[model samples]
Target: MSDEKYRETIIEQAKKDQSAGKFQSESPGFRSLVKSYVSVVSPDRKNIITEGLTAIYKNKNPQPKTLNLIDYLLGNVKYCKEASDVSYAEFYDSNGEMVASYSNGKWISYGTKAENARESELWGIYNEAWNNAARTSQKNSYVAGTDTTIGLMDISV
Candidate 1:
Protein backbone atom coordinates (compact mmCIF):
# COMPACT_ATOMS: atom_id res chain seq x y z
CA MET A 1 0.00 0.00 0.00
CA SER A 2 1.10 3.60 -0.58
CA ASP A 3 2.19 5.72 2.42
CA GLU A 4 -0.88 7.97 2.38
CA LYS A 5 -3.21 5.03 1.93
CA TYR A 6 -1.51 3.15 4.73
CA ARG A 7 -1.90 6.09 7.06
CA GLU A 8 -5.55 6.44 6.17
CA THR A 9 -6.07 2.73 6.68
CA ILE A 10 -4.43 2.97 10.09
CA ILE A 11 -6.81 5.75 11.11
CA GLU A 12 -9.83 3.76 9.94
CA GLN A 13 -8.78 0.53 11.60
CA ALA A 14 -7.91 2.43 14.77
CA LYS A 15 -11.41 3.90 14.89
CA LYS A 16 -12.99 0.50 14.50
CA ASP A 17 -10.73 -0.97 17.18
CA GLN A 18 -11.62 1.84 19.56
CA SER A 19 -15.31 0.99 19.32
CA ALA A 20 -14.66 -2.73 19.67
CA GLY A 21 -12.74 -2.25 22.94
CA LYS A 22 -9.57 -3.43 21.23
CA PHE A 23 -7.60 -0.23 21.97
CA GLN A 24 -7.83 3.45 22.57
CA SER A 25 -8.44 6.16 20.01
CA GLU A 26 -5.25 7.85 18.93
CA SER A 27 -4.29 10.88 20.91
CA PRO A 28 -1.65 13.33 19.67
CA GLY A 29 0.85 11.71 22.03
CA PHE A 30 -0.13 8.25 20.82
CA ARG A 31 0.40 9.37 17.24
CA SER A 32 3.84 10.72 18.13
CA LEU A 33 4.68 7.52 19.96
CA VAL A 34 3.73 5.49 16.89
CA LYS A 35 5.85 7.76 14.70
CA SER A 36 8.89 7.14 16.90
CA TYR A 37 8.33 3.38 16.77
CA VAL A 38 7.82 3.48 13.00
CA SER A 39 11.17 5.19 12.48
CA VAL A 40 13.03 2.71 14.68
CA VAL A 41 11.08 -0.42 13.76
CA SER A 42 10.79 0.23 10.03
CA PRO A 43 14.52 0.07 9.36
CA ASP A 44 14.79 -3.66 10.04
CA ARG A 45 11.11 -4.58 10.23
CA LYS A 46 8.39 -4.41 7.63
CA ASN A 47 4.65 -3.87 8.37
CA ILE A 48 5.84 -2.55 11.74
CA ILE A 49 4.10 0.74 11.19
CA THR A 50 0.78 -1.03 10.73
CA GLU A 51 1.32 -3.57 13.50
CA GLY A 52 2.70 -1.08 16.01
CA LEU A 53 -0.13 1.32 15.45
CA THR A 54 -2.67 -1.47 15.89
CA ALA A 55 -0.99 -2.79 19.03
CA ILE A 56 -0.81 0.64 20.62
CA TYR A 57 -4.43 1.38 19.86
CA LYS A 58 -5.12 -1.94 21.57
CA ASN A 59 -2.98 -1.07 24.60
CA LYS A 60 -0.48 -3.82 23.91
CA ASN A 61 3.24 -4.01 23.22
CA PRO A 62 5.56 -3.71 21.15
CA GLN A 63 4.06 -0.48 22.29
CA PRO A 64 5.41 1.08 25.44
CA LYS A 65 3.38 0.36 28.59
CA THR A 66 1.61 3.22 30.21
CA LEU A 67 -1.28 3.32 32.67
CA ASN A 68 -4.45 5.01 31.57
CA LEU A 69 -5.65 8.19 33.28
CA ILE A 70 -7.92 6.31 35.69
CA ASP A 71 -5.06 4.20 36.94
CA TYR A 72 -2.88 7.25 37.53
CA LEU A 73 -5.55 8.82 39.71
CA LEU A 74 -5.86 5.75 41.92
CA GLY A 75 -2.11 5.29 42.28
CA ASN A 76 -0.17 6.59 45.25
CA VAL A 77 2.52 8.58 43.50
CA LYS A 78 5.34 10.87 44.48
CA TYR A 79 7.36 13.29 42.42
CA CYS A 80 10.90 14.33 43.26
CA LYS A 81 11.63 18.01 43.28
CA GLU A 82 15.25 17.28 42.52
CA ALA A 83 14.54 14.99 39.59
CA SER A 84 15.22 17.08 36.52
CA ASP A 85 14.36 14.32 34.03
CA VAL A 86 12.25 11.90 36.02
CA SER A 87 8.50 12.41 36.19
CA TYR A 88 7.54 9.96 38.98
CA ALA A 89 8.87 7.00 40.94
CA GLU A 90 6.64 4.20 42.23
CA PHE A 91 8.22 1.68 44.55
CA TYR A 92 6.25 -1.43 45.39
CA ASP A 93 6.97 -1.58 49.10
CA SER A 94 5.58 -3.77 51.85
CA ASN A 95 4.65 -0.78 53.93
CA GLY A 96 3.07 0.84 50.84
CA GLU A 97 4.62 4.22 51.42
CA MET A 98 6.78 5.76 48.73
CA VAL A 99 9.20 8.58 49.32
CA ALA A 100 10.22 11.15 46.78
CA SER A 101 13.97 10.89 46.27
CA TYR A 102 16.49 12.08 43.73
CA SER A 103 18.81 9.77 41.77
CA ASN A 104 21.42 12.37 40.77
CA GLY A 105 21.53 10.05 37.75
CA LYS A 106 22.55 7.29 40.18
CA TRP A 107 20.49 4.23 41.14
CA ILE A 108 18.65 4.57 44.42
CA SER A 109 15.97 2.30 45.82
CA TYR A 110 13.49 3.06 48.56
CA GLY A 111 12.22 -0.46 48.98
CA THR A 112 13.22 -4.10 49.54
CA LYS A 113 11.78 -5.42 46.25
CA ALA A 114 13.74 -2.82 44.33
CA GLU A 115 16.96 -3.78 46.11
CA ASN A 116 16.86 -7.38 44.76
CA ALA A 117 15.96 -6.53 41.15
CA ARG A 118 18.09 -5.80 38.11
CA GLU A 119 18.90 -2.12 37.69
CA SER A 120 17.79 -2.05 34.07
CA GLU A 121 14.41 -3.60 34.85
CA LEU A 122 13.90 -1.16 37.67
CA TRP A 123 14.73 1.71 35.34
CA GLY A 124 12.12 0.55 32.82
CA ILE A 125 9.48 0.30 35.52
CA TYR A 126 10.37 3.70 36.85
CA ASN A 127 10.25 5.21 33.38
CA GLU A 128 6.90 3.61 32.49
CA ALA A 129 5.33 4.67 35.77
CA TRP A 130 6.77 8.12 35.27
CA ASN A 131 5.46 8.31 31.73
CA ASN A 132 1.94 7.30 32.77
CA ALA A 133 1.91 9.88 35.53
CA ALA A 134 3.39 12.56 33.32
CA ARG A 135 0.97 11.80 30.49
CA THR A 136 -2.07 12.01 32.77
CA SER A 137 -0.77 15.17 34.40
CA GLN A 138 -0.12 16.73 31.03
CA LYS A 139 -3.67 15.96 29.86
CA ASN A 140 -5.14 17.55 32.96
CA SER A 141 -4.90 21.21 33.92
CA TYR A 142 -3.07 22.16 37.05
CA VAL A 143 -2.34 25.28 39.07
CA ALA A 144 0.15 25.71 41.87
CA GLY A 145 -1.18 25.87 45.44
CA THR A 146 -4.41 24.22 44.32
CA ASP A 147 -5.44 20.79 45.53
CA THR A 148 -8.24 20.41 43.02
CA THR A 149 -7.82 18.05 40.03
CA ILE A 150 -9.48 17.56 36.63
CA GLY A 151 -13.26 17.55 37.03
CA LEU A 152 -12.94 19.02 40.52
CA MET A 153 -11.64 22.30 39.12
CA ASP A 154 -13.65 25.15 40.70
CA ILE A 155 -13.24 27.43 37.69
CA SER A 156 -10.84 29.59 39.70
CA VAL A 157 -7.77 27.60 38.67
Candidate 2:
Protein backbone atom coordinates (compact mmCIF):
# COMPACT_ATOMS: atom_id res chain seq x y z
CA MET A 1 0.00 0.00 0.00
CA SER A 2 1.02 3.61 -0.49
CA ASP A 3 2.23 5.59 2.51
CA GLU A 4 -0.90 7.66 2.67
CA LYS A 5 -3.10 4.58 2.34
CA TYR A 6 -1.18 2.79 5.07
CA ARG A 7 -1.53 5.78 7.36
CA GLU A 8 -5.25 5.87 6.74
CA THR A 9 -5.48 2.17 7.52
CA ILE A 10 -3.61 2.66 10.78
CA ILE A 11 -5.90 5.49 11.75
CA GLU A 12 -9.02 3.46 11.02
CA GLN A 13 -7.70 0.46 12.91
CA ALA A 14 -6.77 2.66 15.85
CA LYS A 15 -10.24 4.14 15.93
CA LYS A 16 -11.81 0.71 15.92
CA ASP A 17 -9.40 -0.60 18.53
CA GLN A 18 -10.08 2.40 20.74
CA SER A 19 -13.84 1.97 20.49
CA ALA A 20 -13.45 -1.73 21.30
CA GLY A 21 -11.26 -1.02 24.32
CA LYS A 22 -8.38 -3.01 22.91
CA PHE A 23 -5.97 -0.85 24.84
CA GLN A 24 -6.34 1.35 27.88
CA SER A 25 -5.76 5.09 27.71
CA GLU A 26 -2.19 6.26 28.33
CA SER A 27 -0.83 2.75 27.92
CA PRO A 28 2.44 2.20 26.09
CA GLY A 29 0.62 0.64 23.15
CA PHE A 30 -1.77 3.56 22.96
CA ARG A 31 1.15 5.97 23.14
CA SER A 32 3.00 4.13 20.38
CA LEU A 33 -0.03 4.15 18.17
CA VAL A 34 -0.53 7.83 18.73
CA LYS A 35 3.10 8.56 17.96
CA SER A 36 2.94 6.54 14.79
CA TYR A 37 -0.16 8.42 13.74
CA VAL A 38 1.42 11.75 14.50
CA SER A 39 4.60 10.89 12.67
CA VAL A 40 2.80 9.88 9.53
CA VAL A 41 0.47 12.84 9.72
CA SER A 42 3.35 15.29 9.93
CA PRO A 43 6.57 13.53 9.18
CA ASP A 44 8.51 16.76 8.62
CA ARG A 45 7.52 18.46 11.86
CA LYS A 46 10.27 19.56 14.23
CA ASN A 47 11.09 17.88 17.52
CA ILE A 48 9.18 20.65 19.29
CA ILE A 49 5.94 19.17 18.00
CA THR A 50 6.80 15.75 19.36
CA GLU A 51 7.79 17.40 22.61
CA GLY A 52 4.30 18.76 22.89
CA LEU A 53 2.93 15.31 22.33
CA THR A 54 5.24 14.08 25.09
CA ALA A 55 3.90 16.69 27.48
CA ILE A 56 0.36 15.66 26.67
CA TYR A 57 1.19 12.01 27.18
CA LYS A 58 2.96 12.75 30.45
CA ASN A 59 0.07 14.81 31.73
CA LYS A 60 -2.35 12.04 30.90
CA ASN A 61 -0.14 9.37 32.46
CA PRO A 62 1.45 10.68 35.61
CA GLN A 63 4.08 8.21 36.72
CA PRO A 64 4.72 8.22 40.45
CA LYS A 65 8.12 6.73 39.75
CA THR A 66 9.23 10.08 38.36
CA LEU A 67 9.20 11.33 41.96
CA ASN A 68 12.32 10.94 44.05
CA LEU A 69 12.41 9.60 47.61
CA ILE A 70 12.45 13.10 49.07
CA ASP A 71 9.40 14.09 47.06
CA TYR A 72 7.54 10.99 48.17
CA LEU A 73 8.46 11.50 51.79
CA LEU A 74 7.46 15.15 51.84
CA GLY A 75 4.17 14.51 50.11
CA ASN A 76 3.02 11.53 52.15
CA VAL A 77 4.65 11.70 55.56
CA LYS A 78 4.40 14.21 58.39
CA TYR A 79 8.16 14.77 58.45
CA CYS A 80 11.13 12.94 56.97
CA LYS A 81 14.91 13.26 56.79
CA GLU A 82 17.76 11.26 55.44
CA ALA A 83 19.52 9.46 58.25
CA SER A 84 22.45 7.55 56.76
CA ASP A 85 24.17 7.08 53.42
CA VAL A 86 27.27 5.03 54.17
CA SER A 87 26.24 1.80 52.49
CA TYR A 88 22.62 2.63 51.97
CA ALA A 89 20.26 5.58 52.23
CA GLU A 90 17.91 5.58 55.21
CA PHE A 91 14.94 7.83 55.83
CA TYR A 92 13.52 8.53 59.25
CA ASP A 93 10.28 10.06 60.37
CA SER A 94 9.91 13.01 62.70
CA ASN A 95 10.10 10.75 65.73
CA GLY A 96 13.56 9.52 64.70
CA GLU A 97 12.04 6.21 63.71
CA MET A 98 13.23 4.46 60.60
CA VAL A 99 10.59 4.63 57.91
CA ALA A 100 12.32 3.06 54.95
CA SER A 101 15.78 2.36 53.61
CA TYR A 102 17.21 1.72 50.14
CA SER A 103 20.22 -0.51 49.65
CA ASN A 104 21.67 -2.82 47.03
CA GLY A 105 18.75 -2.38 44.64
CA LYS A 106 16.21 -3.19 47.32
CA TRP A 107 14.03 -1.32 49.76
CA ILE A 108 13.58 -2.12 53.43
CA SER A 109 10.57 -0.75 55.22
CA TYR A 110 10.03 -0.64 58.92
CA GLY A 111 6.89 -2.26 60.22
CA THR A 112 5.10 0.92 61.10
CA LYS A 113 1.44 1.60 60.45
CA ALA A 114 2.19 4.38 57.98
CA GLU A 115 4.94 2.45 56.28
CA ASN A 116 2.80 -0.63 56.03
CA ALA A 117 -0.02 1.36 54.54
CA ARG A 118 2.20 2.93 51.89
CA GLU A 119 4.20 -0.18 51.14
CA SER A 120 2.35 -0.96 47.92
CA GLU A 121 2.55 2.63 46.79
CA LEU A 122 6.27 2.67 47.33
CA TRP A 123 6.71 -0.56 45.42
CA GLY A 124 4.68 0.77 42.54
CA ILE A 125 6.88 3.84 42.35
CA TYR A 126 10.03 1.76 42.53
CA ASN A 127 8.89 -0.66 39.85
CA GLU A 128 7.93 2.14 37.50
CA ALA A 129 11.27 3.85 37.95
CA TRP A 130 13.17 0.63 37.47
CA ASN A 131 11.28 -0.19 34.29
CA ASN A 132 11.77 3.27 32.82
CA ALA A 133 15.46 3.21 33.62
CA ALA A 134 15.81 -0.21 32.07
CA ARG A 135 14.01 0.86 28.93
CA THR A 136 16.13 3.99 28.56
CA SER A 137 19.30 2.00 29.05
CA GLN A 138 18.23 -0.47 26.44
CA LYS A 139 17.46 2.29 23.98
CA ASN A 140 20.78 3.94 24.61
CA SER A 141 22.64 0.70 24.07
CA TYR A 142 21.03 0.39 20.65
CA VAL A 143 22.12 3.89 19.66
CA ALA A 144 25.50 2.50 18.54
CA GLY A 145 23.90 0.91 15.46
CA THR A 146 23.57 -2.44 17.17
CA ASP A 147 20.66 -4.79 16.61
CA THR A 148 18.42 -4.58 19.67
CA THR A 149 16.41 -7.41 21.13
CA ILE A 150 13.06 -6.53 22.61
CA GLY A 151 13.21 -8.89 25.54
CA LEU A 152 10.22 -10.39 27.29
CA MET A 153 10.85 -8.25 30.38
CA ASP A 154 10.51 -5.10 28.29
CA ILE A 155 7.20 -6.26 26.83
CA SER A 156 5.76 -7.32 30.17
CA VAL A 157 6.76 -4.06 31.80
Candidate 3:
Protein backbone atom coordinates (compact mmCIF):
# COMPACT_ATOMS: atom_id res chain seq x y z
CA MET A 1 0.00 0.00 0.00
CA SER A 2 1.18 3.51 -0.73
CA ASP A 3 2.03 5.75 2.26
CA GLU A 4 -0.84 8.12 1.40
CA LYS A 5 -3.41 5.34 1.24
CA TYR A 6 -2.13 3.78 4.49
CA ARG A 7 -2.48 7.10 6.26
CA GLU A 8 -6.04 7.48 5.00
CA THR A 9 -7.03 4.02 6.29
CA ILE A 10 -5.51 4.76 9.68
CA ILE A 11 -7.28 8.06 9.87
CA GLU A 12 -10.59 6.47 9.03
CA GLN A 13 -10.22 3.94 11.82
CA ALA A 14 -9.33 6.68 14.32
CA LYS A 15 -12.39 8.63 13.30
CA LYS A 16 -14.60 5.59 13.74
CA ASP A 17 -13.15 4.95 17.17
CA GLN A 18 -13.83 8.53 18.20
CA SER A 19 -17.38 8.42 16.81
CA ALA A 20 -17.94 5.20 18.79
CA GLY A 21 -16.65 7.02 21.89
CA LYS A 22 -14.01 4.35 22.47
CA PHE A 23 -11.00 6.45 21.57
CA GLN A 24 -9.39 8.95 23.96
CA SER A 25 -5.89 9.86 22.85
CA GLU A 26 -5.09 11.97 25.87
CA SER A 27 -3.52 11.67 29.31
CA PRO A 28 -5.79 10.04 31.89
CA GLY A 29 -7.76 8.58 28.99
CA PHE A 30 -10.78 6.39 29.63
CA ARG A 31 -10.01 3.28 31.62
CA SER A 32 -10.90 0.04 29.94
CA LEU A 33 -14.21 -1.41 31.03
CA VAL A 34 -12.89 -4.89 30.51
CA LYS A 35 -10.35 -6.53 32.81
CA SER A 36 -8.07 -9.42 31.90
CA TYR A 37 -6.66 -12.13 34.12
CA VAL A 38 -3.09 -11.63 35.34
CA SER A 39 -0.82 -13.68 37.55
CA VAL A 40 1.76 -12.23 39.90
CA VAL A 41 2.99 -12.19 43.51
CA SER A 42 0.95 -9.67 45.41
CA PRO A 43 1.31 -8.31 48.97
CA ASP A 44 -2.42 -8.14 49.57
CA ARG A 45 -2.79 -11.80 48.71
CA LYS A 46 0.03 -12.76 51.05
CA ASN A 47 -1.67 -11.14 54.03
CA ILE A 48 -4.98 -12.79 53.21
CA ILE A 49 -3.61 -16.30 52.64
CA THR A 50 -1.89 -16.33 56.01
CA GLU A 51 -4.89 -14.87 57.79
CA GLY A 52 -7.20 -17.56 56.52
CA LEU A 53 -4.67 -20.32 57.12
CA THR A 54 -4.15 -19.20 60.71
CA ALA A 55 -7.84 -18.96 61.40
CA ILE A 56 -8.44 -22.50 60.23
CA TYR A 57 -5.47 -23.92 62.08
CA LYS A 58 -6.41 -22.20 65.34
CA ASN A 59 -9.64 -24.19 65.47
CA LYS A 60 -7.95 -27.40 64.48
CA ASN A 61 -7.48 -29.97 67.19
CA PRO A 62 -4.11 -31.16 68.51
CA GLN A 63 -1.74 -29.39 66.12
CA PRO A 64 0.61 -26.44 66.10
CA LYS A 65 -0.95 -23.39 64.54
CA THR A 66 0.45 -21.91 61.30
CA LEU A 67 0.26 -18.51 62.94
CA ASN A 68 3.79 -17.42 62.14
CA LEU A 69 4.23 -14.15 60.26
CA ILE A 70 6.03 -15.94 57.44
CA ASP A 71 3.22 -18.41 56.86
CA TYR A 72 1.23 -15.91 54.78
CA LEU A 73 4.04 -15.08 52.42
CA LEU A 74 2.28 -17.20 49.77
CA GLY A 75 5.66 -18.35 48.47
CA ASN A 76 4.88 -20.69 45.57
CA VAL A 77 1.34 -21.39 46.58
CA LYS A 78 -0.83 -21.11 43.46
CA TYR A 79 -3.91 -19.03 44.19
CA CYS A 80 -6.49 -19.79 41.49
CA LYS A 81 -9.81 -18.12 40.84
CA GLU A 82 -11.82 -16.02 38.36
CA ALA A 83 -14.03 -12.91 38.20
CA SER A 84 -17.31 -14.79 38.14
CA ASP A 85 -19.63 -14.85 41.13
CA VAL A 86 -18.84 -18.53 41.48
CA SER A 87 -15.12 -19.31 41.56
CA TYR A 88 -12.49 -21.12 43.67
CA ALA A 89 -8.78 -21.17 44.67
CA GLU A 90 -6.28 -23.88 45.45
CA PHE A 91 -3.12 -23.11 47.38
CA TYR A 92 -0.20 -25.20 46.24
CA ASP A 93 2.98 -25.05 48.31
CA SER A 94 6.50 -24.51 47.01
CA ASN A 95 6.85 -28.13 45.99
CA GLY A 96 3.67 -27.96 43.92
CA GLU A 97 1.60 -29.67 46.58
CA MET A 98 -1.87 -28.52 47.38
CA VAL A 99 -2.02 -27.69 51.06
CA ALA A 100 -5.58 -26.40 51.14
CA SER A 101 -8.30 -25.40 48.73
CA TYR A 102 -11.47 -23.39 48.69
CA SER A 103 -14.13 -24.28 46.11
CA ASN A 104 -17.73 -23.39 45.40
CA GLY A 105 -17.54 -20.92 48.27
CA LYS A 106 -16.45 -23.67 50.67
CA TRP A 107 -13.13 -24.44 52.29
CA ILE A 108 -11.70 -27.91 51.90
CA SER A 109 -8.95 -28.41 54.43
CA TYR A 110 -6.24 -30.95 53.92
CA GLY A 111 -4.51 -33.28 56.44
CA THR A 112 -5.99 -35.73 58.87
CA LYS A 113 -9.71 -36.10 59.28
CA ALA A 114 -9.63 -34.41 62.64
CA GLU A 115 -7.79 -31.47 61.08
CA ASN A 116 -10.52 -30.95 58.55
CA ALA A 117 -13.17 -31.41 61.18
CA ARG A 118 -16.83 -31.10 60.23
CA GLU A 119 -17.50 -28.94 57.20
CA SER A 120 -20.64 -27.58 58.84
CA GLU A 121 -18.61 -26.29 61.78
CA LEU A 122 -15.81 -24.87 59.68
CA TRP A 123 -17.76 -22.18 57.85
CA GLY A 124 -15.87 -19.40 59.57
CA ILE A 125 -12.55 -20.62 58.28
CA TYR A 126 -13.92 -21.29 54.81
CA ASN A 127 -15.61 -17.93 54.53
CA GLU A 128 -12.52 -16.04 55.59
CA ALA A 129 -10.25 -17.93 53.24
CA TRP A 130 -12.53 -17.74 50.23
CA ASN A 131 -13.32 -14.06 50.59
CA ASN A 132 -9.66 -13.14 50.99
CA ALA A 133 -8.65 -15.14 47.97
CA ALA A 134 -11.45 -14.01 45.68
CA ARG A 135 -11.79 -10.33 46.51
CA THR A 136 -8.08 -9.54 46.39
CA SER A 137 -7.51 -11.25 43.06
CA GLN A 138 -10.42 -9.46 41.44
CA LYS A 139 -9.42 -6.09 42.84
CA ASN A 140 -5.63 -6.05 43.39
CA SER A 141 -3.13 -5.45 40.60
CA TYR A 142 0.55 -6.24 40.28
CA VAL A 143 1.10 -2.45 40.29
CA ALA A 144 -0.36 0.19 42.53
CA GLY A 145 -2.96 2.58 41.04
CA THR A 146 -2.96 1.04 37.59
CA ASP A 147 -5.50 -0.29 35.09
CA THR A 148 -4.12 -3.81 35.38
CA THR A 149 -6.75 -6.27 36.59
CA ILE A 150 -5.82 -9.77 37.62
CA GLY A 151 -7.82 -12.91 37.34
CA LEU A 152 -6.43 -15.16 40.08
CA MET A 153 -7.64 -18.12 38.12
CA ASP A 154 -4.03 -18.70 37.19
CA ILE A 155 -1.91 -16.88 39.80
CA SER A 156 -0.72 -17.38 43.36
CA VAL A 157 -2.30 -15.82 46.46
Give per-residue CA lDDT, model 2, range 10-101, as digits (tens): 44444444444453243454446444433433322233223323333444332222545654443222212233222344444433455555
- lDDT per residue, candidate 1, 66-101, as tens digits? 545653433333333222244333332223434222
Candidate 3 similarity to native, TM-score: 0.23
- Distance (Å) between predicted and true CA of 105, model 1? 26
Among all windows of 10 consecutive residues in model 1, the one with the lowest summed lDDT is 40-49
Q: After superposition, how far is residue 15 of candidate 2 from its true place, in Å?
A: 35
Give the Å shift of residue 103 in candidate 1: 24
Off by over 4 Å in 2: 1-110, 147-157
Can you list the residue pairs that collide in candidate 3?
Answer: 79-156, 81-152, 81-153
Question: Per-residue lDDT tens digits of candidate 3, residues 1-157?
Answer: 4435533443444344444444423312221210000111112344445755454444433332343435534433333333322244555444344556677778764442322343222333333434544455556643533533344433555
Candidate 1 scores a C-alpha RMSD against the true structure in Å of: 24.1
Residue 15 error for model 3, in Å?
Answer: 86
Q: What is the Cα-based lDDT of residue 140 in candidate 1?
A: 55
The weakest ten consecutive residues by lDDT in model 3 span: 33-42
